[model samples]
Target: MPAPNAWVLTEGHAGMESQAVGLAEALGLTPEPRRLRARLPWDWLPGRLWPVPLMGVTTEQGPLAPPWPGVAISCGNVSAPVCAALRRRGVKAVHVQHPKMDPAAFDAVVAAVHDGITGPNVIVTRNALHRATPERLAAARAEWMPRFAHLPRPLVAVLVGGTNGRFRLDGEVGADVAERLAGMMERDKVGLYVTPSRRTGEDAKRALADRLVPLGAEIWDMQGENPYFGLLACADAIVVTCDSVSMMSEAVASSVPVFILDLPGKSRRIGEFIDMLVRDGRVRRFDGRLETWPVTPLDDTPAAAAEVKRRLGL
Candidate 1:
């Protein structure tokens, strides 16, 4: 059972929530997730610079009142001040990702190596924290294996991400990606399962679905429970779009061979991260081939959690 003694703070963003929840679970804490929203001018300003942190936080669920937890795991710059405020009140606060401010404010700042931020209080990791535990994988495998039994062996999981500030995955690009993945499935006789993020625009998903689904690929249309964990558990190879560091981090953290699908536009920072993995032989670029290779997972969730424990003596 998870201990209910921690709070996972975010601005209600999926990526931020995942990282914060991942850390809290790693700490054996069943956290109360709170989304901090700042109204008016406060929302436009930097959370790190807030004079009164609590003043900026308001939750639709309830007011940001007291009875705070012993631990606060925060992600997202918007909600960072709330974590700092909790820390000042004697709660141990840990921030995931770069806080975009001084790292010394939190008990520990969990950052990625690519971010290039470092301090005594910083815990640098090769990948982002996620909620992909071994036990969860085992359970997913047990639950989903039967459902996917008819799909055949060598199942490939394709994670499709859409447009972001840096990259674009429009219909044309989506078709191109779909064509390549479909080629892999047809050529390799692999069962292809594709999942798209909310960022995956409808047109992009349609493009992918139109092409890949006809080739016996299973693409989740964002209905029912997200089969993401199931795909992770059952995949022999994982192909993920390069728009998100968090998504790539989760895939790269797995022992399965990972293939990075390229998108339009250049993101040099994320490119550097991909290059690091490529140099290490842990990942390769997707080019219509289902090539297999030995992969040793490079996970940092436990390490970050351990740092939290070490810092807070929890």
Candidate 2:
């Protein structure tokens, strides 16, 4: 028999939702994405009130609880209170990524080793888990290959991300990176598949299009229909900015070698994580070389799922 329904919650963020979906797939569980509602009066206090809307608004009718699933898996800070509510009703709660609060609140916490969170209930991984199955990769290749069929022989994938309050992804930086990549493309007659994240700045997107798109590259803004996975699957090599660990993790999951763009003043956690990966020979920094190295895949989703199942005896 199939596993019981799992409720997955995200605050409308693609990355968090993607991770929840990936974990559900890895665990062979059916996940139903549910919108969460806030239950606290403090949730409506001014600028702090963002969570009220992000987590659906509470009503005079009652506490708007969605259908209770056998399990609840959540990502990001917004899901904490919602997960707690589910737990109160004896629902199993599994949280992916550091809770940004206490780990003890969740039944199991799946965190990145670089997150510096260690606990009995915590499962640390080198990178975030993703669902990059061979079937998905094959499908992506089939869909994207024809678009770049006439561009060039070798293709380079540039995955762009924007600032996350702690960092800045400026147009000048994108131009600089694009220039360096364009130089490499010129020498190798390379094709380019560039995709920007939702956080990616408008100026950066424009800069990339103005500087790199005309050089036989296909640029995908948020409006573009192509899936980012297709770019990762079809590229000879990937160039990712140092802002997103999830993006880096997905790139490493691909068979191709990944090169991270330089971010001088980014978080120390990112630096430490990159250092560990480099020392372990999993990924390389962008230094004008396309080389492949064997990577020890550290997929935590299955392990986490197994542990959860074992705990629940399901």
Write one digit per residue (lDDT tens) for candidate 2, span 76-178.
Answer: 7767656655776788888888777677877888888888899888878777867775668788999977876776656778888887855677888767777
Clash pairs of candidate 2?
A: none
Model 1: per-residue Cα lDDT at residue 236: 91
Top model number, lDDT: 1
lDDT of 1 by residue, 186-262 (tens): 88899999999988999999998999888788889798989898888888999999998888888877779999999
Error of 2 at 227 (Å): 2.9
Off by over 4 Å in 2: 1-3, 35-41, 44-63, 292-298
Model 2 is weakest, by summed lDDT over 10 consecutive residues, at 46-55
* Candidate 1 C-alpha error for residue 147, in Å: 1.0
Best by TM-score: 1
